[model samples]
Target: MPIADLLDRFRPGASVYLPGATGESLALAQALAADPDRLRGVEVTSCLLPGMNGVDYAGLAPDARLTVFMLPAATRESFAQGRVRLLPLAYSAIARHIAAAAFDVAIAHVAPPDAGGRASFGIAADFSPIAWNAARQRIAIVNPHMPSMRRGSSIALAEADLVVELDGPLVEVAPARPDATARAIAGRVAALIPHGAAVQVGIGGAPAALWAALGDHRGLRLRSGLASEELLALADRGALASDGHVAGIAAGSEGFYRTLADRDLIRFADTRETHDAGRIGREERFFAANSALEVDLFGQVNLEWQGGRPVSGAGGAPDFAAAGIGSPGGRSITMLPATAKGGTISRIVARLSSPSVSLPRNLADVVVTEHGVADLRHASLDARAEALIAIADPTMRDVLAEQWRSLRTAMA
Candidate 1:
C-alpha cells in the first residue's frame, strides 16, 4: 500500500507504539507527523530515537502526546519542555508495562522475509515483540537494508496486519573511542573474566573498550543488552564460544550491520528474556561489566541522575548486576573514572545527592577505576569502605579514609 494510505489508517485517540533506538522507522514517523490534523489526539510512545524525525509531537497536534521510557539526546529537550511524558521504569519491566497498557498499534522496522517467510526484528528487539502482541494492529516496515537475524528474533509476515515495503538505510551510531582512563578501567574489568564465561556488557565507553581487551581471551560468550562492532570483532577473532550470542539490540555503524547480515551467531530476544535476573542467575560463569556515573561509600551505584536531572534510565544495569553477582561462579564488575570535571570532582562520594540508586550496595561486587580494582563481594561495611577508598583517586583517598573513620565513630 502507499505510505499516505497506510498512515490514514490511524484514528484519533489511538495509542501507537514505535520501536526505538536503531529500529525506529524514520520514513513512517515522518509520514505520521506530516499532517497534524490527520493524527489529532493520537498518543505515540517510544524511546531512544536517534534523529530529529518524530520528536516534536506537540507541533504535530495540540492533543497529540509523546511518551518515552528512556530519555535520548534528541528528545531530552522536548521532555524538559513538557512536550513529552517520561515513564520511568527499569529496562526489564518495559515489556510488562507495554503489555498492561495495550496499545492500539505497534509499528516496527524489520528485515525482509527469509526462506521460511519470517521477518527479523533486526537491531531493535528490546520490547517490540511484547508491544506488538498487545497492540490491536500490528504494522511492519519491511526494509531490505535491515540485517536478517537468527533464532527467535523474527516475526511471521502473515502475523502483521499491515506490511509496508520500504528500502532505506538503517540509522548508524558510531561508537565512542575510549581514552586512557577508560582503557585502564577496561583492562581491570577484562582481568576479572575467566575463560568460557557468559559476558553481559552494558553501554558505555569503558564497556566498549573492554570488548577490545577481551579479543585475546578464548571461549567467551556474549549475553548482552546491546551488540556493537567490537562484539563482531571478538567473533572474528574466534574469541566467542560456539554456543552463540544473545542480546536485545544491535547498535553500531553501517559497517557493523553489514558484518552481521545473514549471520546466525547472535540471537535477539525480548527484554524479559534477556534481562531476567532469575534466568541470568542460573547461567553459570556469568560475568556482567557495566559503567556508572557515581558510586557512594556504601557501594551504591547511581546511573540515572546527575546533579538533579535525569540523564539516563536505570536500564539493565540493576538486573544484570544482581544476576551476575548472585551466580555461583559469576562476577559483576562496575567501571568508572575515579574523578570527573577535569579531575576536580570525585566520582566516589560519601553520599549520593541524586535520589535514584541504580544498584544497591548489596549487589556490588568488583569496582574498577584507573587507580585500581576494589573487590567488595564479601566485605563488611568497614571493609567495603576501605576497599572502595583504595581504588579512588590518590588525592581523595585520605579524605575518604577520614570520612570513614568519622562514620565508624558516630556509629560506635
Candidate 2:
C-alpha cells in the first residue's frame, strides 16, 4: 500500500509507537508533532538519540500524554507540563505490556517492498512487533535508506494501515571508543569473562572497548541483545564465535550492517527468545557487561541519569544481569569510568539520584572502575561500600568518604 494513503487512516488520540533508535523515522515524528492534538500519547524507546529531535510532544499539544517505559517524565523545556508520563516496567515485561492492547496507534519503519510483499522491520525490532499488533492502527515510515535487515521477523506491508515512503539517513548512533579510564575498567571487567559464555553487553564506551579487547579470547558466544560492530569483529577475527548470535536488532556503522549481512556469522532471534531468562539460563557460561550512571556505597546501579536528567532508558540491563548471574557459570559485570566531566561528577555516589533504575545490590556481582573491580555478591552494605569506594576515582575519594560518613550517620 502507498504510504500517504495509509496515513489518512489514523484518528485522533492514537496510541502510536514510534520507531526506536535505529528504525526511527524523523519525518513521521515531525508529521505527528505537527498535529499534536491528534495523538493522545506517544510511546518511545529512549530519549538518548543524538541529533534526532521533535518526537516528544511538548509544544504540539499542551494536554497530550506520553507513555514511556522507565524514561523520566518530560519537562516543560522539552515537553509541555502534564504532557509526559512514565510507565515503570522491567525490560522483560515491556513487550507483554504493549501487546495487551496498551496503545491505540503505532509508528515504525519498514524496508523497501520485496517480491513477496514483505518488508523487514530493520534494526529496531525489540518491542515493536508486539506494539504493532496491539495498536488499533499502525503507521510505518517506509525508508529505503535503512539497510534491509535480512534477519528477524518480517512485517507484511499489506497489513499496515499507514505507510510513508521517504529516503534519508535513518538516525545513526555510532558507538564511541572508550577513553583510557574506561579501557582500564573494561579490561578488569573482561578478566572475569569466561569462554563459551552467552553474554549481553550494554551500549556505550565500556562495552565497545570490551568488544575490542575480546579479540584475544576464544570460543565466547553471545545469547543476548543486538550485535554491535565490535562483537561482529570478534566473530570475524575468531576471538568470539557464537554457536549463533541471538538478538532482536543490530546498530552500528555501515560496516557493521555489512558484516551482519553475512549469513554464517549473524542470525537474528525474536525478543521473546533472546531476552527470556529461562532460555538464557540454559547456557553454561553467561556473562553480561553493562554501564552505570552511579554505583552507591552499597552497590546499587543507576544507569538512567545525567546531570539530574534521565539520559537513558531502562533497557535489558536488569534482564541480562539476572540471567547472567543465575546461569551455571555466568557472571554479570557493571563497567563504568570512575568519574565524568573531568573530575566534576563522581560516577560512584553515596546515594542514587531520585528515580533508581537498578536496585537490589545482590543482583549485580561485579562492579568495575578504572582503579579496580569490586565483587559485591554476598557482601554486607558496609563492606560493599568500602569496596566500591576503593575503586572510585582517586580525586573523588575524599568527597565520597565525606558523603558516605554523612549517609552512615543519617542512617544511624
Candidate 3:
C-alpha cells in the first residue's frame, strides 16, 4: 500500500512523537505533508538535522503544518510565522513526556529484524523508547542500514500498527577531532578508570580517545547511551567482553556498525534499565565518565552550554552520576580540559559558566586532567580547588590558583 493509505489507517487529531534524529520521524513528517489534515495535532522531537536540510512542513507540503518540539537552533522567524510549535525540555525528559500521553503517534526508525524477529532502535535511543510507550499507534521504518543492536527491549510485530520497510544509509555522526588539549584531558580521565569496571561514556573525541586508551587494561565493561567505535574496538580485543559491556545503543564508524552485527558482546537495553540509578548503584565497580564544557571552583560541571548557547542536553548525566556515586565500588568522573580555544579561556572557573549539571559538585567524585585528579567527594570548595588546580595545565595553574584564592578569601 502507498504511504498515504497507511496514514489514513491511523487516527487523526492525536499528538505524535517522532524520532529526534536517525530519519525515522523525519520520513513520517515528510509523508504527512501530503495530507496536512492528518497532522493537525502532530508533535515531534527532532534534532532537526533532516529538516534543517530544507525539509519540514514547507518542503514536505506547502499546506503542511505541525507543533514541532525542536531545539532553539531549529526555529527561525519563518518557522515562527507558520504553525510550528516549540517546547523546551531537557533531552532526558523527552521520553518521559511522550510516555505520559503527551503524544498520539510515534514514528521511529529501527534496525532490521533479528533471529528472534525483534528489531533494534539502533544509534539514537533517546525518546524513541518513550514514543514506544505512549503513542496510540506505533510505526517503525525498518532500515537495514541501522545497526541491528541487541538492546534490552523487544517489541512484537503485532504491537506495531504499521511497518514500513525502507532501505537507506544509516545516519552517522562522525567524532570530532580532538586537539592536544583534549587528548591530555582524555588521558587524565582514562587514568581514573580501573580495570574490570563497567563504564558509561557519551560519544565524542575525548570520550572515544579515552575508550581507545583502555587497550592497556584488561576486562572492562561498558554501559552507555551511544556506543562509539573505540569502545567496540576494546570489545573486539577482548578487553571489554572479558569483563562486561552493557549498552543501550551503538553509534560510530562502519566498523562499529558491523561489530554490532555480532550480539555476543554488545546488548541493547531500555533507558529505564540502562539508566536506572538504583540499579546502577547496586552494580559494583560502575565508573561513569562524561565530558564537561566548563567547571567551577565549587566543582559544578556544565556540559550543556558554551557562552549561553545550547549545545547538548543532560541525556543520562544525572542518572549515571547519581548511580556511580551511589554504587559502592563505582565512581563518577566529569572530565574536561582546563582551558578552551587553545588556552585562550579557562574551563575551570571561579563559578559555573552557567547553571548546568554535566556534573554537579555534590555528585562528582573526581575531576581529572593531564595535570592531576581532584578528588571532590565530601571535600570543601577550597580543598576541591586545590586538587583541581593541581590538574590544571602548567601554563594556567598560577592564574587558576589566584582566582581560587580570591574566591576562598571572599567566602571566608
Q: Give the best candidate by lDDT.
A: 1
Provide the clash count, candidate 1. 0
lDDT of 1 by residue, 1-412 (tens): 6676668767798988877778877666577667667668788887664331335654477667788766666666667778778777777777688878788898878998998889988877888888888888898889888887766478888998889998777777778689998899999888889889999997778998999999889999888888887887888888989875888887887668766765676788888889998898999999999989998889999887877888778778888998898787999998999999999889998778688778888898999999999888998998889988989998998998898888788888
TM-score per candidate, in order?
0.94, 0.86, 0.84
Alpha carbon lDDT of each predicted model:
0.82, 0.69, 0.66
- lDDT by residue (65-136, candidate 3, tens digit) is 444444334444436566555444433454455567545567678877777678767666655776677767
Per-residue lDDT of model 2, residues 170-220, tens digit only? 655577778887788778877888766666887778888888877778888
Query: Lowest-scoring 10 consecutive residues by lDDT in candidate 3?
Result: 50-59
- Check candidate 2 and list the clashing pairs: 3-163, 6-162, 15-105, 16-105, 17-106, 17-107, 58-79, 197-285
lDDT of 1 at 27: 69
In terms of lDDT, the poorest run of 10 residues in model 1 is 49-58
Tell me, by TM-score, which candidate is best. 1
Clash pairs detected, candidate 3: 15-104, 150-268, 151-268, 152-268, 152-269, 221-244, 372-391
Which lDDT value does model 1 have at 35?
Answer: 65
Candidate 1 local distance difference test against the native: 0.82
Stretches of candidate 2 off by over 4 Å are 33-54, 61-63, 70-76, 139-141, 162-164, 262-264, 355-357, 395-412
